[model samples]
Target: MTQRSTADRAVGGLGPWLPIVLGMLTIFGPISVDIYLPSLPALRDDLAVTPALAQLTLTACLVGLALGQLLVGPLSDRFGRRRPLLVGLGVYVVAAVLCSVSISIEMLIVARVVQGVAGATGMVIAQASGRDRLDGPRLTRYYANIAVVVGSAALVGPLLGGQLAAFMDWRGIFLVLAGIGTAIWLACLTGFSESLPHDRRRAGESSILHDMRSLARDRAFVTPVLVIGLLNGAVIGYVSGASFLLQGAYGLTPQQYSYVIAAGAVTFVLGGIVAGQVGARRSPRALLPVGIGLAIAGATATLVIGVLDVGLAALIAAILAVTSGTALTVPSATTIALARRPDIAGSAAAVVGVTRYALGAAAAPLVGLGGGLSAVPLAIVMLVCTLGALGAWLAIPRAGEGASGD
Candidate 1:
């Protein structure tokens, strides 16, 4: 009998459920943010807070997400995926309950922070778990499949939130979130197995800071980190401001705005599917430009649409193109970041998360800098971010040049 390697055995244990489990784990972060959006206005009125104050609830969650990943990365590397993931999910359910019962804006904000921190464990570990089981093309496909699952969650979150809002008050949304969290927690408890065995984990042991410094010095790693990081920032900036552009400026209703979001989500899923298949054959370095070019084209078109006051159809088309293009790079860039850093997979994943959340937070504020009245702010943000991603790609070594992470 042939002796199976540890990775092969681990994959066998997880079976066909690895991508689905990891995808569901990752969904909490985005779903936590998006599910409460439709309830924002009501949440503000119920607590008698300013719109800005109510929005702080969102800002709190985002900060928790960033910090939580930073804090959890090393722990996951040390303690393994299952423990941290389970604890976090448990806390998330509790946090959801807290938010539902909060009597003041301050209370809600605090609860959201707890919720975000708890939800973040799911995201980082999901990425690292993929690294634990596979490499090369299979790893690429795994990440892409996660992207498809995440995009679908984004599409469903707002739709579900909207329907819930119509039937119940703002607080009920949190209860519903709590229920979803409970179900996922139970599923993970029964179905999820530890992918990172202790022996493999011990072999790579090192200080978190040391591992981070090592990763930072690697040009191969930094390239994709910056690429995906900036692209995510741009896409999030578009999302933060799209409501303003469509409703405040162009006079579309909230329901109509949601339709555009759904369309973008669909395109995003398509891009992920296509990119995963293509990336199975091409190296990450080779595939980066294709993604970047699409992003640039969409950004430029968006800029034109904003400057010339193009009608809603053209604007939506351009924005959707940007969404799809950004999605195209998710698997390619991530494979580049985590593939060669198997020993430090958790920290490597965390570095990407830190950049992603930090830039994402920065980009959201930029949409309001132009007073939320024109598409110009959103367009500028998209163009600048895509240009940043383009520059990052250019910094990487050419095909003939050496970079094993590829």
Candidate 2:
């Protein structure tokens, strides 16, 4: 049997196990991101860095995620998905262990960069594998399913990390992550099989430099890619600023902060579920605005409320609206982005992936400009980001809008 057929049988033959495996793999990045959030405050004290500098740790991870996908996407196209994933997860294991042992903040940052780079492989590969089999709304549903898993991780990882850090110290968080990496690595070896076959592999490929050029030139490809990136970038912005916004500005305790964060995350999960249900019924172009609208309204309201010195209850309600809106928007954009060119889904997804995280990484510093923890600064930053995302999405033409065919 052909490798593609074998993979199809392996993946398509099993019903629940396939998505479960994909879900686990998808959650790896979220775990890497959220698991460390609760530890940021403790690390600030231990590393003796300013709060802004401490925030760079998260930025570093995001940068790593962006760059790693840039490398892994093409490699997966050439070598198949499974091999690079194994290598990436293996690297993550080492980085996680190194993070645990680091004596200085610089070392920890470097280790996190490595971990982010390696951890992103799972994300890119899981996407490529999903694209190899599914398309259109079906693929959107798959992404929604993965989001639920990843979203749940976002909810749980921080709480777990917070409790762990509270009791055991921040180093323990990294150690636990290392253990999770080991388990995921083993799962890759046993349960997961290659989806991209050699016969289908892109032959005589351009240099990585040239592939980037080609990606930039494809407008149909680039539009949806940009849409996904910008939307995801907005989420990353929220993540980058969330800790400071809650703990530093609002004066919530770490444990309390996790619960607050959990509330936002639950909205994210709800958004994904809603997207899966409605993505087919609504045009992606139409849905993109919903998220942008929510973000704009939420951020703008928060800005006004913060200016007026609103209390916690009001602030939470506004933020939840934005979160809920983002949840609805992301999956639909992703489904549209990957609709065409089933063959290069890895590279396609990677393009959007890189843009999202890269923007997210930048969002950290941008939001820090006014004041790291203050209310007005964060509200303004989120307002601009959400508005920007809305403009970007509106600029792009959809499949049926002007284009003759899909």
Candidate 3:
């Protein structure tokens, strides 16, 4: 079979609406996590679970997300994007329904794990589909657009969930998610087309292992994947602990906390917009340092303020800074890593997704290890993660070369 450039694939009859549809599909993970955050306290009380176990529900979902991508990415490469994506969405609808009616904490956690695994299909396949059809600077722009969609969802999902929690209940959030999953499934059935041609599909199970090993051997791929994971972990650490910090420590109501979260999310959107414009002009190497520097500064400051027990305004500002940096870093890092091996885009996207969510899952429970009374542990974890990301970026051999499309 002949190889094709992303430019060639762009002209290979992909519809214009595909990006928007994929963007919608890609947010399944975020929606699953963010939409029910305001209900965490209520969930604990209603289910009679401990605080640590309450956070486990989130951790379980993250674990499922990480593992699901690890499994599905290669499957899509062997099979096709549409089939795996549809199957995942079907599972997501069922899991969401189960979550809505969960009778105990254990049941809810299990349901969330299944829900996250199913949700992973959307995140991985959306990115793989983009890779299947675009490359080079076009690929970078596509990821930037995805960042924007995710940032928007980050802003909207919590606010909507907070409102729903005030009026309805925690179960109501799951019901709404089920409805959303069903809608996405229907959309996929009608509007989506297979991006990977049959000629391009990988041959066998060994091919999956081979592709994974090849990616592991490439420094260009591994470094950016690590950086993305660390940066994502930092942000997720803040998210996992934010509810307790804002509600329990700062004494804010769910509605009020949602506004604070929304403000930080606005900065995330701004960062994505800025990264898109900068990426168009500069390479990933130039953008990565700027982002990492901002993250380190923000996380360090958060650590200091949290230790001092300063006001909520300082905390929010620091969180905003970290999130803004991530908005810039994640898209550029993902584009650079995936661009390294366009032939195995599905597998590549999967590796990146798995690393990101795995690190995030590890970070979430750490925030509550100190019992979530203060934001200090959260700040410390975020700072450590940012520093780790910085180290990974610096370790990249001739990082600028990796950023280039050649």
**Candidate with more favorable, higher lDDT: 1 or 3:** 3
Off by over 4 Å in 1: 1-5, 10-13, 202-205, 398-406
Query: What clash count goes with each model?
Result: 0, 1, 0
lDDT of 3 by residue, 108-147 (tens): 9999999999999999889988877776666777888888
Residue-level lDDT tens digits of model 2 in 1-406? 2543555765553255666667777877778878777678888998888998887887788778878888888888778888898999999999999988988889988998999899889898887788776665677777777777777898988777767877877788889989998998898788777777676777765566666666676666666666566556556666667678788888988678677778888988888887777665655556677777887898888888889978878888877877777777777667776665555667877887887777666665676675655667767767777777776676666546553232
Q: Give the local distance difference test score of model 1.
A: 0.84
Per-residue alpha-carbon lDDT of model 1 for 30-78, expressed as tens digits? 7898888889999999999999999899889988888888877778888
| lDDT (0 to 1) per candidate | 0.84, 0.76, 0.85
**Better model by lDDT: candidate 1 vs candidate 2:** 1
Candidate 1: residue 175 lDDT (0-100): 95
Which regions of candidate 2 are displaced past 4 Å?
Answer: 1-14, 40-57, 103-107, 243-251, 280-286, 372-374, 400-406
TM-score of each predicted structure versus truth: 0.93, 0.86, 0.88
After superposition on all C-alphas, the RMSD of every candidate to the true structure, in Å, is 2.7, 3.6, 3.4
RMSD, model 1, all Cα superposed?
2.7
Rank list by TM-score: 1, 3, 2
The worst-scoring run of ten residues by lDDT in candidate 3 lies at 1-10
